[model samples]
Target: MTLSNDTLSELPADVARPGYDRAALTPGIVHIGCGNFHRAHQAVYLDDLFNLGEGHDWALMGAGVRPGDAKMRDAVLAQDGLYSVIELDPAAKSARVIGSMVGFAEVASGNAPLIAAMSQPSVRIVSLTVTEGGYYIDPKTGTFSPTHPDIQADAANPDHPETAFGAIIAALKARRASGVPPFTVMCCDNVPHNGHVTRDAVCGLAELSDPELSAWIKTNVAFPNSMVDRITPATGPRERALAQSFGIEDAAPVTCEPFRQWVMEDNFPAGRPALEKVGVTFTDAVDRFETMKIRILNGGHAIIAYAAGLRDIEYAHEAMADDQIRAYLDKIETTEILPIVPPVPDTDLNDYKQLILSRFSNPEVADTIRRLCHDGSNRQPKFIITSISDCLAQGRDCTGLILESALWCRYCYGTSETGAEIAPNDPNWDRLVAQSKLAKERPAAWLEMSEIYGDLAENAEVVAKFTALLNDVWARGSHSVIADYLTG
Candidate 1:
């Protein structure tokens, strides 16, 4: 008999579902943003801990920052708070049941339940996967954007706040008043020194409301920086079909690449589950890992995605499969980019490069160029800025990175090579498009916006290189430009 949806209740007798008495599991952690990356990364780790008979007292309570998250709430609830995760690799495929999350804290309705959950004495960790933009930070300045309407609303009402920063501060105040220990604020976003950024945003918002409370937060809260990696694509019909095939009635099952890594600073104040037993690397400095991953992997992603998108390549693997584009990526990383990266213990950059290539070439994942290309304004600063800075410092040729930036600027123009109308993805898409057009007319126009490129735009040599490459890209298109750079 084929595995049926009804058979899911009892884990097929043969397959042990990591038995943990549900009655003993209580919600001890509150997570914001119940997205795919969270499901495939942190939740998976927590599930592993629970399966190992550890973290039995800890369960996840999902919370959303936006009303659009209501759909995810409904989906997780339909599956008995259970979800399927498929890990795909070129060599193998593995599937697992993740049951770390127990309930949802509806944030759109009101902050009352969410605040209460955070205010729980038993809740020791308040984790986040609120993407880069959710930080409400100024992309140019790298500071909390208080003028943002969300931040403004949060600043206006210090006590009952809506933004994540507000919620955290309000919850912290409740803990302070009630004589409860504060939960460690763990940030799982991809930003550099995420803990520090989280600290700045939270305390920045808090300072606006009450200076004393902000000072208290600085003294008490522990923001641990983390480096999390898992290539999980957005769910589509194929993913839905995969879940259905497994006889699982999952409304929002997540499909991810087999590879995963999470490195964090070991600094939880109240208490934390011994997650190290389940493959979490707790270290003093996550800077090396963060820099290595962001510069090579993420930086390469930006380089290839924009270049490929300009050539009308649909998916990432498809772009990687193209010999010309693949060679171009290899040349850029090895020659211009890799030398600047500080060495990590036991990490062979060459081997890692090979692994990245294989992962990108995996046809099954179908990671889209457009998905990777979204939010260039926020992403480029982290992914590309450092490499560009390194090159400028050493007086090395940044011909390739400059070309990559030009491609990104061209991509923001919102029209594809085949004249297809590209939809806007970034919060600043309109601004990016208007500036890019003006820049194309006067090659340094966009870069001159000191806020984005800083002084890099005014440097005659850098502007000349970028302008030349931008002109070449417009003349011969993406592949040819890449081929020319690789050979000459």
Candidate 2:
């Protein structure tokens, strides 16, 4: 039977449904992105809270701004905002219907309904998982791009906003006008210092239009930095079939690895869910945790994905099981990535790196190379390039990282080592192709993407080293390049 309140009782015994009273659940959070990651991570936490009967007042009210979100809204609302979260493992699997989401707003056109929904006093937290690129941040300056068309449009017409941050500003404006307290803006995206970046985006946009409103947000609103980790692949027919095996006919389901973690600073101003009651770790400082995960796990993903892509390895575990690929990842992490990460409280960095290796080698997870390698423009800046910056600052041996960058540049050339076609994977695919083509000739041409490389591209010493590797990667091939780097 389809997963819904009316059909909850009819679900198979293997599939779990909420035991708490769904009707008692109230809207306390208006999440701006309703994608699979949010379902598998934050919504799962809230679902656990509701099951405990403690966070009934903190139910999630889903919202989105992308055009594709309108379709997700229809699917979610069709099932009364109820969906199944199926955890994947090599041996066993489990499924549950999460009931923490109570409603969704119509976001097909402008975010009028979303603004109206967030304006309500019940919505005390406006959380988001709007991807790493959604924040409109300049990767070079690490500042909000006020000149972005959406920000420009929103600054011009704040009431009829077009972006999620703009909608948030409009809602805050309404709340201020109505004499309601502003909601805490929680950022659950995987960006580094996500809360600060979110603040820069919303507050920066606000300043362009209303200096007073920007001051109010700066003074009153809360943006909590968080470290969210889970390997939730995009739901597909295979997941639908898996759900059916559990006798769940959920139209919208999220599938992820059994492992999950959420570490965040305790900075919610307008009340929040009792997520700590679940597995979430609340801390006074989240910087160390975020840095550890972003560097070792996130950056390591880039290392394996790009290198694996060059080898045409299809899945994460398969690539990880490859001796050379695993060594490449460990070499980069231990020598380069780990040294740059500051000490996380009560956590051993080496052990954490091992744990990440085991997680990546989970065979049953079936995470694809394409999924990991997608969005290099965003992932490289936050995950890969940041570490390069630290290496440059600390004068560390960055040979592995330099080779990884060369692999990335080669991967962007749209072909694999064995003459396999690599389809466009980056948001700036055209630019990447043009630069890669030029770099194939000049070897220094790839650094011309200043928007991504920033001033790092102009450093003659660094460029010389990178160009040497780029030339070797092209002349000798990726495998020989890796093998020689390993031995040399």
Candidate 3:
């Protein structure tokens, strides 16, 4: 049976469906970027809350600004906004159909429909999962880049904006003009201070056209910082097959590890669901939790990704199974990354590190190495470079951290150790490839990209170590260099 509102009762006996009345559901949240991660994480949380027969008015209305989002909107609306979440663990697997999303806004040329949907008085909250790179942050200064072409275009034509932040600003303008209260802007991305980052983007874009409106947003809007975690891989044939195995054909079935977490600041002035009743942690010190997770888990992914990518490993679990790759990850986190991370409340950092390792080792998720390694230009600055900066500030060892940077540079050369081509993975692939070629002769050339390395390039000690490690990798191969680092 095809998965839809009509076929919900026809699903397998074990597969869980919504217990509440879908017809009575109301939209309280307008979420942008309805990708795999949002479907698996936030949507699942709302699904659980609705199952408890509460927050029926807090249903999700998905919206997006990208052209690809039109495809996702079609796939989701075809099944009446119904899809399956398949949690995979080595011990067991289970499927649940999520119905928290009541509708998807039409994807149009000027985002008129999205702006109209968000301007509704009922949409008390606007959430986003637009990925780390989508925020238009300047890598060197860690501030919103108002000069970006997309931001410029939106500022020039605020009435018919093209970007998500632009549409948000347009909606807020409508709400303010028509005597409606402003909605809370919640960011669910993995970046540190994600809420603050979102506020910067939204208000920064607003400042371009209307400084008064920008001040109003800064004063009235509440952007709650959040940390979201779930090992949901990109949906493909395998995941669709898994859904079919459950006797429900779902076009966009999300397959993920059984573990999930969301640590958020309780700053929704417009109100929010009682998500704490459903395992979401609302805390004052969300930054501490954010730091622990980003450095250890996301940073750990970067730690293992380049080496595995160089060696032509397919899945993240397969890379973890490699003794050398696993050992490198363990050593880097213990010595370089964990030492600088601040104390999270009621949590042991060591135990958290172990949990991250276990999650990476879960064979059932089948998370891709390519996915982990993609977009190094954006991710390296957030995940790996921050830890290196902290270690440098405290006068600690940065040998492993610099080596990780070298591994990324080597990977950008576009070839695996096995002589296979590594297709372009980053948005700035051409520039990275050009720099990688130059760094082959002079390793400092890679660090010279001030946009990425910033003042870190001025440190003689870091420069020398990076040069040596990168040279060793190009000369003797990644395996040999890794072995030397392990023994040295």
Using lDDT as the measure, the top candidate is 3
Give lDDT per model, in order.
0.83, 0.90, 0.94
Per-model clash counts, in order, read 0, 0, 0
Q: How do the residues 1-488 of candidate 2 rate in per-residue lDDT, one tens digit apiece?
A: 78778999988888888989999888999999999999999999888888887978889999999889989999999998899998887788999999989999988566889999999999899999999989998777878899989899989998788999989999999999999999999999999899999999999999989999999999999999999999988878988988888988888988899999999888887888878899899997698999899989999999999889998999999999999999989988998889889998999999999999999998767889999999988888788888888999998878888788889999999999998999989788998888899999987787767777878778887799899999999899888888987886
Off by over 4 Å in 1: 1-7, 10-16
Evaluate residue 289 in candidate 3 and report its C-alpha lDDT on the 0 to 100 scale.
Answer: 94
Please rank every candidate by TM-score, starting with the best: 3, 2, 1
lDDT of 3 by residue, 180-255 (tens): 9999999999888999999999999999999999999999999999999998999999999999998889988999
Candidate 2 residue 263 C-alpha distance from true site, Å: 1.1
User: All candidates: CA RMSD in angstroms?
Assistant: 2.1, 1.1, 0.7
The TM-score values for the models, in the order shown, are: 0.96, 0.98, 0.99
TM-score for model 1? 0.96
> What TM-score number comes out for model 2?
0.98
Deviating ranges (above 4 Å) for candidate 3: none
Q: How close to the true structure is residue 227 of candidate 2, measured as C-alpha lDDT?
A: 90
Q: Give one digit per residue, the lDDT tens place, for model 1 in 1-488.
A: 12223445555333324456555789888999889999999998988899888887778999876778778988787665777887766676555677788889875644777888899998999999899877877866777777888877888887667777788899999999999989999999998899999999999898887899999999999999989898899999888787666555566878899889999999987888888998999987698888888988898898889888887899999999888888888988888788888887668887877788887888878899989999888888789877997998987877888889988888888888778878996878999999889977887886776656767886888888888888777778876788889987
